[model samples]
Target: MYVGLVGCGLVGNKRARGLGSNHRLAAVADKDLTRAESLASQHSGCDYFADWQAVVGHPACEVIIVATTNDTLAEVATAAIDRNRPVLIEKPAARNSKEIEPLIEIAERNGVPVKVGFNHRFHPALIQARQIWDTGELGDLMYIRGRYGHGGRLGYEKEWRADPRIAGGGELLDQGVHLIDLSRWFAGEFADVDGYVNTYFWRMPVEDNAFMLLKTIAQQVAWLHVSCTEWKNLFSFEIFGRNGKLQIDGLGGSYGTERLTYYQMSPEMGPPATVISEYPESDDSWEMEFAYFIDCIQHGCEPQGNLKDAKAALRIVEALYEKHTSGKSVRL
Candidate 1:
């Protein structure tokens, strides 16, 4: 399938390499001509353009990938779907659903489908976690906990991510969106969600740290703590169940870098059961996610990370934003 790229920034470049494979990089565009050319030149037959509309409008490009900032994701996605092209937009979908919901409505009106990129669900470790849950190996889940963030924008005054208007926020929207989605995925739909966020350490406009409390539909509670100010850490998720607990220690790539371990009670009754661990050596979340989208496009199947999932995840963000600003609990 021929694909077009809208941005050549860090995530765009990384996905261009990882998602490139045998798929056609028919066209590419970026606000920066230099960056577009640099990335386009890496693969043959990839046309370059300065304006994103040009890339998405190219007749030869069958699919469009929107990797621009949160500000332009909705605009790019809406236009692409209008042209009857399927699209894969990077996370958060938009700064808020206000910016993206219309695109969802537009796609629905046109009978077209666009996918929001939530690559975490495609991770090997997450895949195993889901399998364990389905198999009842971990029994009924009790709680879900996660931590995901970085110190990439530590001292930036002019970074787009530091600006709430551009990035939405630091911990919650920027990185915590992944954990928020993961929390819902592991613990089921949230019965209630309430949280706190703060701006600290860095002199940025958005909150850099956040903590959330959630209860699943069954009243099983979970905690999601995320921070963008942490200088040297990564992402991880732990699931507590009736029988034991499962923890996944790596969120290194679009695919993960760890295994699923079960800490069950030992037969001796006084000690813990043997901790049995299972590892799926392959970590190709990027490839796996893109392949799933390809399948969705090819089979006319609804996407796993479709626009609907994107909206559901962003709803939590909206609630968090309302709560943070209003200093009152907001219902989802």
Candidate 2:
């Protein structure tokens, strides 16, 4: 794949790195031309552009990676799709579900696939948990609980994420979508959504903290929380099944060592059986997800984190925001 990346920020660089030797970084674009040039310089023959249109229109570019801010995601993706190019768009895909609908429609019309960057699904621990759950040993899933947060740095409130126009929503649309996507991965679509979001710490229009309780028609539940106010960075996700429980913690780096613990209920019911898996090294989810996207394109298969998944998660987000803005909060 000849990749063209837009954004040239941390995520854009990560996507370029993920491409590695297996693919080519043919072009890159960002609002900051210097940043685009810096990334493009790292790869031989890679071009830099100030406008994303040039990046997507590059004659040699076969794949597009849109890692821009929330507001521009859908616009760039739609442009790429218009050219019949497959795009790997960063999540929350867009500012809202409505913003992403045109991109999805364009992708389908062009016979191109739009892969959303829900990289958490590619985490080694979560992948293993999903595989195990698929074996039916855990029986029926009951509920899932997820907590993901990070401590903001100095001047965090002034970042693009703190701006409602740029970020769409606060932590909920940011990290919260990951939890919502993961919860859907385990328990399926959430038919009911109730949540509360508030700017408890950050001095921004967007909320710094959000709490959600989602339930499926099957009665399976997902309780999730995301925040930018946590003094200590954290990532914890627990899934309860009829026969056992799977708990995943951390996300490597500042969140600490990523690990998964499985507790199976034995007939005797005391202590049961326990198994643990830990990823003590760096995070490879970026590369893994990129590989999956490549495979999907090659095989003409539907991707795990396609536009539908992004839209589903975004729907929950919009619902929560609607509830919050309507002066309804703190409900079960």
Where is model 1 more than 4 Å wrong at Cα? 253-257, 266-271, 274-283
* Candidate 1 residue pairs in clash (backbone atoms < 3 Å): 265-273, 266-272, 266-273
lDDT, candidate 1, equals 0.80
TM-score of each: 0.93, 0.98
Lowest-lDDT window of 10 residues in candidate 2?
323-332
User: Deviation in angstroms for 69 in model 2?
Assistant: 0.9
Candidate 2: what lDDT? 0.91
Top-lDDT structure, candidate number: 2
RMSD of 1: 2.4
Candidate 1: residue 67 Cα off by (Å): 0.3
Q: What's model 1's TM-score?
A: 0.93
